[model samples]
Target chain A: MEDVRLLMLPGPVPLPERVLQAMMRQAINHRGPEFGAAYTESVEVLKTCFGTENEVFILSGSGTAGMDAAISNFGKGKKIASLVNGKFGDRLYEIASRNGDATGIASEWGTPVDLAALEEALENGAEMVTMVHNETSAGILNPAKEVGRLARKHDALFVMDGVTSVGGDEVLADEWGVDVAIVGSQKCLAAPAGLAAVAVSDRAWDRIVEDRPYYLDLASYRKSAHKEPMQTPYTPAVPLFLGLHESLMMIKEEGMEARVARHHRMSASVRAAVAAWGLEMFPQLDEHSAYSNTVTAVRMPEGVADADVRGTVKKMGIEIAGGQDHLKGKIFRIGSMGAVSAPEILATLAAVQHALRKAGVAGVGDGVEAAAEVLNP
Target chain B: MEDVRLLMLPGPVPLPERVLQAMMRQAINHRGPEFGAAYTESVEVLKTCFGTENEVFILSGSGTAGMDAAISNFGKGKKIASLVNGKFGDRLYEIASRNGDATGIASEWGTPVDLAALEEALENGAEMVTMVHNETSAGILNPAKEVGRLARKHDALFVMDGVTSVGGDEVLADEWGVDVAIVGSQKCLAAPAGLAAVAVSDRAWDRIVEDRPYYLDLASYRKSAHKEPMQTPYTPAVPLFLGLHESLMMIKEEGMEARVARHHRMSASVRAAVAAWGLEMFPQLDEHSAYSNTVTAVRMPEGVADADVRGTVKKMGIEIAGGQDHLKGKIFRIGSMGAVSAPEILATLAAVQHALRKAGVAGVGDGVEAAAEVLNP
Candidate 1:
């Protein structure tokens, strides 16, 4: 069989073989004991991964669905302060604004979130404040903990979008005082895309006035998940849950600290290689700007079209992502989230250098050496 | 390996090996041409399965999520007349009521929908009517076509819960004049649970006033689906779509008419075996009542405990279902949804007979013989 393309996109990450096999297991009765055990274990494992003892519900949708649950459950009729620095952050603001009265603290694309502006918004009349822990669109990590502390100071509940960071970064959900933290299975979990996990604190639950949408009703999810045979309110994506369970087990085996370090190592390696290739980083390159450990965004080289680079990479049986929305065609992103390792990262850097050379770009100084410098160090 | 338990539950039907392998296929870039082709093909196949030339969108949640999209998209502030005869139907009413002004036309759980009552409600200033094509909780098929005709007569859009009937039985969405029909992946499609499909008519799309609840926003789904590289508004469950695509291909191979016939045959055989075992069929077993072709509800014998029968069958490596909600402990259901065959049906019946006999029930007839008669005939 031909080798499968390396999936280095922000999500739907290249799944481990065991996780894939878990998804291939025979169907089980969702209402039966087998599924009950799986569901119960999945919730516990997800909480452990999120670093929270608060309530977490595994939902049968994408990360956006988790974002919807967080916003719709507590944002309706409430004063919401949303921080927007990238596409996902914009989505958080959009979801909240659609549901209730929301004030957006907007930041320029590719820029770090302004905590002072967020604090000002929260100090107004905001009851809930939303922020993305890692913004994939900009390849930057937001000041989630700082935002959480500010929200707490202003008596506003903090809802965090940890879609790309929860399992890959040091996301201390409870310690950071986040009321709701949302993540997707396909991100750092190394599972298939289809499941979203939402960690809800008592504060977020208490703010739910009524059930808005039936399918995404967090109150119902909490009630059902607390049952003896813990389960979601509706029929879950059983195979996806199985994949997640296996992925979480793999994470447990790796240990959270090791996983986070591995991700940081890969991030540093990618950034070094991009620098060696003489390409500008998309997000501000500074200590305060906070580069993402999950994905690295680099500006496209002059005279090298984004499509040509991506097309060449695809021909080499590797897949990465281009910039999204307004940043499309301006930058290319290399995602090292989930099951990605040093070998895969080195291979990706090599392929991009080859693609760049083919596009007549010069000064692509030994990509492998640059990446190994950080990976070995 | 030990034989897996026979998943004879309504949803999460035993997946074919090809479908399972398709799910195990490596993740593809959601924005790439590969997923675009898959998405476009899936939409076409789903349209074929629903027998509709109307618009179809693949969503990343349970059937309940599809129901939400249908109601939330068009039912907000519109007078809705919802027909409720079972749990799912009641859920439809609840979803619609939460979104808009709705009046429910309630019916006995195990009885068919009262079309006259629905018509009367529609005539009384109702702008939309919702009904379930097959109510799994009650193991009965509602008169959806009749209700659709009545809804049309009253100038009301008809939304249907085709969750259990879309692929298992006859569901001609366009011919039945269904403005919107919702189905789940795990049900008759024999795909893993995680995805929902909504087939919407022009009328339904025209009625969407505002995009509320960002994730379930149908307008956004339509817009993205119409793009060059067709895609979901959010990250879709890619593996589930792959499995569904394979399952749909299998359905196409079997031909819809033959598939429907096989489901009917299995339903008849299960009903016959129950009768031969001196068990009464639930859901007002009558010609007019239209028992579900996908699942059959059987009353528990006087001396037999529900758990005892279910446990015995489970021990024999088979999994059937007990009644849900109000019918729990009173009736048990035998599901013959996708991929079920005569041998499996006969084995299930024999196991049930053995369980009944073990429960101190006397004169347990040869259930295999009864089922064989229906299968062989």
Candidate 2:
């Protein structure tokens, strides 16, 4: 008896059987032709998926490693401006501060980053600017394009943490003037949680100095990628690469335009269910901030402890995430990203409704019904 | 319809079906109690496997990342002596050179590190000494215990890269005075590639200072591992962790002593087969330079091209490794690590014999017969 739970976290989402089967395949030599072809193909697919013609590399680590790469590659001795709207955004700032001279343009957790504050930091002689496309912690999608424009205007390199956005949202890395865009395999890619894909622009490459961290060295990645048969500087997580290749193929088959549309539709349904449940969204849903298409952060109702809400759902073989950092116990998050279906979303909503009611909450109109209205319509 | 090849390479060796199945398990929340329990259990198992009471932490990247961690954590502004006998030893030196002042006590490939040389380097006021236990690139097992002793005598932290040795070889971390021992999952652990486990002694912990690479920061790893329920500072490779847990369980069931004996037996059989085929061993078989019990390096016979031999064997659904760097084309390697069996070793020997014949370089007696003698008597 396999007791499978709904994986509704921001990452490590439910992987397809095909992807898992790919991962189960025998490992190939990292320097061999087999891995070379796979690496080259995967990089090309990732470039297409991220909407960037820049150099893309797959690192054998989590998204945070990619973030570190972004920061360490160009952060040294540079005045970096990090836009912080949520936990992940703050992490970028923290990483920048540790590796470089960085000034954080902080914002309220549930609000989008202020554009003027970022511009002011850049004007104050910041050489690079880092922003998170989707703040999974607060369930808010920051204005990446608007910020990118400011970064370009100030002649600063623009780095985007697209970990929770690239695959599920509209991330035109090149079009948005993003010099570097980083994504994780486990997020919307629906592979596993071991690989991070980072696309670096030519401009960013030009800015990269020799003092980069060896493990996170972009030039090494570039040289390896440029090899006739692509390779990594070190032994890669081969199974993760195979799984990512499968997931990227799936993304290609689904087409990025259709994939983004489907995410929009599914996320809308979940938001409708939340609205029907009379729960407030954690991030302010306004013109300035876009609600994350991947995860929905909902404020917990009075008397309903966040743990009880998540625990009850877990009892029903469904997993939802709770808030991080300062918002802990005050909000719960439902991630509807990566290979999630309408039926699965409806079942999750029904389970959430039951969980909420069991946690001393009432008067929530049938959540599933509300979601169905959006799905069918 | 199983077209399985003999995965006779250094790592990513043939994994048991149970380990593959464990890796197939659905994703779980990283911050959940389930992962915490799993992390705690895996760390304890790793400590036992490593033959140490030191604090162990599993990283999401490859063994190289662990090497980076070891160098960056303690080598900051400190003088480090790297005993280089092979490619991996040089890597440790390179890592140290980038992060700290490092002196390389270099030796020829396939030669065991000279204890006197290492002691001399340590005597030069070096604060740390790094070396590889089993040099996968050269198939030479360095005298780690002796080197560790030298390091201890000089009051230098001993960092051991046990990537190809930990699970299958005798690695008495504490007994050998190894302050830091790093191992990867894919090597002798028989798990998929991705995760690296590092055990740190109290002496090494005291030497850790700030200004280390952010991602490889040991203090963060220690703080997370010491959590009420163990955790990683960043998102870990969950599937790899699950696979490692299964592999660790397999190690426990087999008993470490039995496992190491089995590896020694298998590697000896392969070496015997190579001798029967009249192929010279790559590394000098002497009292000092011990051949690896994981991978056996065989010098190619005259007129027998390395690729031709490997290709011929691969045509018979067997995969062996060619040498790396300068040693490439000069030697071929047969890996007998992890979950390999007696039958598999015999088949590989037979395949190698046939391949050598096909390469027009065979006047040697039955290789399988030679290996069988070693296996049986």
Question: What is candidate 1's lDDT per residue for A92-111, written digit by digit as tens?
Answer: 99998998899888888779
Score chain A of each prediction against the true chain A by TM-score and list the results.
Answer: 0.96, 0.97
Give the CA lDDT, 0 to 100, for residue A98 in model 1: 91
Using Cα atoms, each model's DockQ against the true complex is 0.69, 0.58
The residue-by-residue lDDT of candidate 2 on A1-377, one tens digit each, is 22446878887799999998988877677777778888888887788779998878999999999999988997787899999889998999989998889999888997878888888888899999999999999999988889889999999999899999988888999998999999999999888998999998888888886777777777888888777678988888888898889898899899889988888989999999999998899997557678999999999998878767988887888878888877889999989889988977988898899988877787887778889988899
Angstrom error of the Cα, residue B204, model 2: value is 0.4
| Candidate 2: regions farther than 4 A off | A1-4, B1-4, B285-287
Task: Give the clashing pairs for model 1.
Answer: none
